[model samples]
Target: MTTISTVDATKFKHVSYLWDDAKAAALAGDEVALFIYRSNMLGADLRLTNYGGGNTSVKLKDVDPLTGQETDIMWIKGSGGDIGTLKKSGCAALYVDRLRSLENVYRGIEFEDEMVALFNHCIFDLDSKAPSIDTPLHGFLPFAHIDHLHPDAAIAIAAAKDGQKITEELFNGEIGWVGWQRPGFDLGLQLRACLEEAAAKGIKLRGIMLGSHGLFTWGDTAYESYINTLEVIEKCAEYLESNYGKSRPVFGGAKIDSLPEADRKLQAAKVAPILRGFCSSERQMIGHFTDDVRVLEFINSNDLEKLAPLGTSCPDHFLRTKISPLVLELAPSEDLSDVAGIKAKLTPAFEAYRAMYTEYYNTCKHDNSPAMRDPNPVVILYPGVGMFTFAKDKTTARLASEYYINAVNVMKGAEAVSEYTSLPRQEAFDIEYWLLEEAKLQRMPKPKALSGRVALVTGSAGGIGKAIAKKFAEEGACVIINDINEERLDGAKAEFVQIFGKDAVASTLLNVTDAASTEQALDNACLAFGGVDIVINNAGISISKSIADHSLEEWDRLYDILVKGQFIVSKAGIEVMRKQGFGGDIVNIVSKNAVVAGPNNPGYGSAKAAQAHLTRLMAAELGADKIRVNTVNPDAVISDSNIWAGGWAEGRAKAYGITVAELPAYYAKRTLLNEIILPVDIANACFAFVGGLLGKSTGNALNVDGGVAMGFYR
Candidate 1:
């Protein structure tokens, strides 16, 4: 099995997208589309993380008719449903209020029991499987769509010693941290309280960290929610992976015995009921043998506690078993008869573990009666014996075993770098009981700068072009959205007007390549509003053509729209900007091809190259005139406009006769940071440049292309 590295630079390049209200509304109103979109998004979210390692949900509440009951419901992805590849049946429907109620009662109950009860309350919408352990977390949120992921990059940083402090320093207000909690009711309560407090204090919460668990993000729309989560995680992951994520250490394992075939079968039968019981009545009966000699030896290791706690990665894993059982470590050819000797040697250890558990329980005793639970250590490791996970149900046992096994492997691999040190023991304890921190989280607020601006975006009809325009509108900008196609232009305008008030947004059909037409459009925009402040020159096209077969006409046609169009619109907007003297911002959507040759698409590449060069020229001349000209070099933006169906990397792999599976790493291997650059990545760059952090950074190329091509200073 592949171990998730603490510093896998390869994991930092993916982009996240969130669905906004408009998109959500579209999905909700269109049953067929909603089905497609929701499933598509779920599948994507799951694949983005590891098995049973992420969470996703959709808000399904609506007002009641007549006798008004604000019955809030959320259709959440079941615990095992991988968001990246979920079906409709994978979601669970839970009453939000009911789920939220668990928080209020949590203080009196142990967190594990409380969470299990809360999960049991969820009623599957369809005849689906049991809900995910993260079900309570989904039911706790008010967002329409919620997603959580355990990205390698984010985990590396979050799992490190002093992780909380480091996360606070890096993400600041843009993200929140919840330390670590066993996934379930307790975590849900913590998250809910955090959201409430954030709202009360007006803390714009962009994302939340579950310490050792993973990351969570939400949006009114699935795209926005997904994207925001992706962006924040990607940012942290990329930063950490580069600077602090890589820490390899050296370690060795001891040898132990393998269980006999007869004993292995007997053990599997013994563990079957335990696994089945924990998996929520699922009768999944398949079982695997752990008779491998290596497994036995490792299980017999003397320092299991020093190796880990409870033989699991995180807590709350008791859902599968009362405890992890150790295999009797013995000789390589040990048979069932050796069990007596193994048990004798380890009997004292078991007794000690039970005594410790009772002591812990005694310390937490209070007036309110608490539910009794199993007193045994949930998991035990014997250096040379194969580990055993006991559950009432096969599925639960399997999940538990898989999780612990993976955790052990990850620890073992991580031990290769540096020994994994979670947040300090006291810190972990504090976070585990941190009700105050839990009560401090709030959903992220809308952008302040975009609250009152009336901006226009060219190419506001499709793909990245429309996405930028829609983003501005969502942030409260009075968008003068435009497109070359009248039909698409009208559709987008209608959508925006409906979303941002008809009075706040407008649309026009104009060919940006036509200088005269653009000039007229600019006048109309000024006449309609006062003036445009942010000019996003995203109106452009690309065509695949080899230089050998390419004609001057092809080059001119591409340039006329990509380069000259930017010039025409920017020139017109600049005059109005100068009159107002408000210091306007212009974002030129350039590509990596501007710096590195695009090979086959010479016409498109040459024009983009010129446009990139001209961006510096404009910056030089426009600085005196109070206009900021910046170019966004997007690399391999995975969208319908490109040949890639899933993403550019995947598409390129197919073109090169390689499997899509090989692309992410292959592309990552080519870059210094091994990151895949996305359009939203460019959008973020534009946001920063337009926000004016660059100060005197005009006439410079910001390397946003995953460090693929670094341009020299002119």
Candidate 2:
């Protein structure tokens, strides 16, 4: 049998005691502010709890809006709020008296769900957000301040087979225990009964270890409660460390060695898109890949087959990662470089996982249960590589991976001391399909048009390219902004990070005319966001010269950047999109000159005409793969334009027999609509083509030239 070694005490000791007396004193009179401070402190550490997994509360006397009298009110972390980023507005304030009175209406365990709806009537503040199901758990407790957390170390003890005995020995009766039950009115009642039973025996209970659930700690003051929570978790860690001193191997030692770091990442990049496609069987999913040492150790271990099948013990872990991960059925000595072989093996494994999930749903479902959700696995484990998680967006996918890492920690701790246990299959099903949980899922806002998609925009450091990238980011697509200019690319990246967050944007220096540079850029996109679904071929250069004056060098440079650039980028990007096994979009940023004939513009106009025709040719060829190719032609977009800034404005003015300052007016006057074109106008046209509105239409060009008569498709 495989066995685990003791935990390093130093690992737990690293969770610092960060409470500052001066900071606490600064908010002495405001109990809610104090509560927020305490919550923030605990949530700032993932060792304490995973993101959005814990709840905290402070019972205080506040003026009741309806009665105009001071009454006891409980302010608890509300539904769908993270304690780490919590605000006063994120809390649910409820009347304690009204909450306690609900015990009279509580029928039994079967009807506990009914209590959730009644909680709205107990609202002390009309503006309060809806209460989480855990509200009753906090409100029923008598403590002035309370915290319920799913710390990895604490859940380790809670998930162990001998958890009750370990709890008694470690806390010496200070912390009590309750059997596993789903969080609701019934479990809240169980908690109160456990505390009362301990008190009747003359035991001073400081906290309670929930069976296969989490830990609860409370105190008369906010700081005291924070300290209590920390103390209990630290004690649990110390106990585990003492029982099993680091002497034996973790997870029964490694069955297979991990690949080299670079090789592992390459393997991950190669397989991520295939895994993403399978996981997105129900709906499109964004992907996150991690080669964290902890994950690699577990997946490479002999106990992986034994432990991973049991699933995660914590609700937060399983809810995000699903009951169990889909483990690839590959041999320890198998070569990972064969991506096609891996794909062939994954297809059957994926189907089996789906079958298993369907069986789980059908066996455990009840009449009132929400319909079965996507049966595809959220987490996929590769032995030599690491972990891959997919979700509706990048952040969620990343969070799922983090939660699974937490689960790995819990499993290590539990197995080190005693046998590890997971929540029963039926219980897991009930929680996953709970009506309240389904309602919460339904309450989520509709996803933006470009949600879950990743886009790569060339020449995105400024002007039309940047505008298009920004618009894609606004619609919830992760964007990789590219340009040959390092300074402008960095500036644009920083600006995007500030507005859309770092996770939503990435930047790379790309010379689209070079095949190797284009391939490397696409590879960077795959590493950053799994794969690229939208390719914007917007990079260009201009040379305004007549047939007699045009130099061969200048003509070749124009075609190299304007025509061949789009072809190279499209070719490389299509390879990635094909590997992803999903359809994608390719938008060519051609010019109005592609259709309109003009003098002194032979080099620029001819190259653009080639780009326009290339769009149609690729659209026709790639339609079998479901990749759409389209064109957006804009005329005289002088604002923030790289081409205009690079002397194209002066050349155009000279051609039109006008001053350089009159170029914008000159171009607008020649248009049928006489409207000045802007970068955002071009961006909107790009969005219209790929934003699902024109999803069925492709191999077409929409001119954004304010209706130039000569540029019209005749």
Candidate 3:
């Protein structure tokens, strides 16, 4: 038996006090100003934590000088305040004793009510901000100064399958693992129960593991607790790096030599987008586990389900990695870059996973059923092709991928210990089918502009194309979304119905540039929803060209799609919009070049001009027919929208002589209103023009350009 000795206090006692000069100064200042400073500090460190990933609090010890009676006047981190840019109001001050008392009767209580009760018992002289979900977790720690962190290394270790054992070895007997569960008061209650049990058993439990969630460490002093927590995580990371952190293996589970060169190159290109998609969401965890042997092995594994044993790392991760990866058995004659074929192969697998997940949920409970999550894996690691993460939002997708990477390593280590003791299938089913989580999955908190409307967006495959299509879908509109990128198109198809329900969505892969293809796509839309009401002419591309140096063929090709393609689709859609009787919307997505002159944009600008004028002419003709036509002129929407163009970060960087870091002000300041418009911003405008609000608006060009082109607007 190994008996641990208390270390010399000197080694861990570098700074016993919680607040140093800087922190104290900030805390002493006006509450609002202090919060702002704290928030910025928190924002700067990816490891200390990411936004909403952790919590912090200050215990105001109030003492009557005459009586010497001291009481804890609590100021806790507010619910939803990003610690990096914390505000004074961001911290909710609840009476410490009331919070402790609430814990005694908090079983099965609703989360929101529990929070309200905490706010009601406030003692601090500050506006009551809703307390953080981890308020109870904060309350559980009996400290004057407390802080919690979801440090990258902490998550990286927590993601491991044998997390408890690894955490024990790294943090030793000083830490406790609370198993996996949802966050909020329930988690707080769980942690308290564990602490009470430890006390009864004559065992001391300090830090805690919230299972797949993160970690919590507290102390009487802020700096002491913060550094101690950091040290514990750094040590755990060091431990893993020393032992189980093996060399990242090359992707060699399958023979890529059989694949064609073009296909291989395509797959290589696809790898970055998938990886980027994952990392983009959680930038704080940059380069943490981009390449891991277990991740690679799991990607290459025949039994891929083992990689995602207990579903996604959390809800945000689910958005990126989806439900599972698509496993493909490369045939002798198959071409790897046969993008369409690869998509076809994966479709059935995705459907199968969906079916299995649905069945698992249905069978687990005889009393109630929950809505199903999107039938997609947030972390899809495609063997030799590497991995891809998907999410409705960029930040979440990246975090999901990180979680997946961490989870894969943990599972690998745990398997080495024994068959990894995963939650039972029934338990897994219960989580997957949890009613509250299901509600979040099914409910949209706010109504979308195009809600209840049906739209058909052509070229809804990838980049700007997919963003627009998704924008419409997100606004509660059932979309007949089309795209040439069949794999992505199909993936979106599966997700749209999963998110919006089967009755609200339909998808097909068709090239809008082809007249016949446009006609067929329009027909599909009409067939799916009984009629098509809104048509977003988003199927266009740019050829980097100057008229002086560009070939005639390239110039003609740009016109073929940009101008001619819009004509074909809009013409076809008008027939359906008329038949539907409800006045329809036609939004021609044109570039800033249509109004603002720029060099080397001859083809793109000219084609867009034609489309813009066509919009006016169509509006004039379609107006009496009760159909509205408008132009959505957007200035450089920073996204994967512009084809193989570098990407949002690159474009913003190039435009302002700075990296994506300086882009908020750099891009925004350039605009008259200093607005850096996003794709969603443009989509909402388009929805307005097409929906009831703009039913009376027509024949006008709406600049969704964030005041970048004021002169052209009038």
- CA lDDT of each candidate? 0.57, 0.88, 0.60
> What is the lDDT ranking, best to worst?
2, 3, 1
- Can you give the lDDT of residue 692 in candidate 2? 94
What are the per-residue Cα lDDT tens digits for candidate 1 across 1-714? 111122243443643333344666766664324533644554454224555556666775555453467676677666545655666666666667666666666664354543554555645344645666677777776777777776555554556555667677778755677867656566776887777777787887777777765678877765556556666767764564354324422224343334565654444333322321222122112222343443443454443445555333333222333333443333433342343344455556556655664554465444542433455443434333355443322234345555555454334433433345443343333333334222222222533556435466788766666677666666555567788788988887787767766655667777988887786676556434435678888887666556776678867878898888988888877765654444667888887778675446677778889998888889888988677888887766554333243243443464455787776566556677778766566666766676546756676556665667443333
TM-score order of candidates, top first: 2, 3, 1
Q: Please, what are the lDDT tens digits per residue for candidate 2 over residues 1-714? A: 111122232444836566777898899999999999999988999999989998999999988777799999999999888888889999999999999999999999899888999999999878898899999899888999999999888888999999999899888889899988889998888899999999899998999999888999998888788777877898887776775536567888889888888777776776777787788778888888888998988999889999998998888888898989988776534564565677787889989999999999999999989989999998888898888888899898889999999999888888888889998999999888888889889989999999999999999999999999999999999999999999989999999999999789988889988998887777677767788899999988877878898889999999999888988999988887877777899999999999989989999998999999999999999998899999999999989888886677777888889999888888889888899999999999999998998888779999999988888897
Clashing pairs in 2: none
Candidate 2, 73: how far from true, in Å? 1.3
Q: Ten consecutive residues with minimal summed lDDT in candidate 2?
A: 1-10
Give the alpha carbon lDDT tens digit for every residue of 325-413 in model 3.
Answer: 44444442445344445545655655675577566556676376554445444454445444445443334444655656645554554
- TM-scores of the candidates in the order shown: 0.40, 0.95, 0.55
TM-score: model 3 vs. ground truth: 0.55
Task: List residue ranges in candidate 1 displaced over 4 A.
Answer: 1-54, 60-63, 67-74, 77-142, 149-159, 169-173, 180-205, 227-305, 310-313, 316-318, 321-386, 409-714
Q: What local lDDT score does residue 704 receive in model 1, on the 0 to 100 scale? A: 68
In model 2, state the lDDT of residue 557: 91
Error of 1 at 197 (Å): 7.9
In candidate 2, clashing pairs total: 0
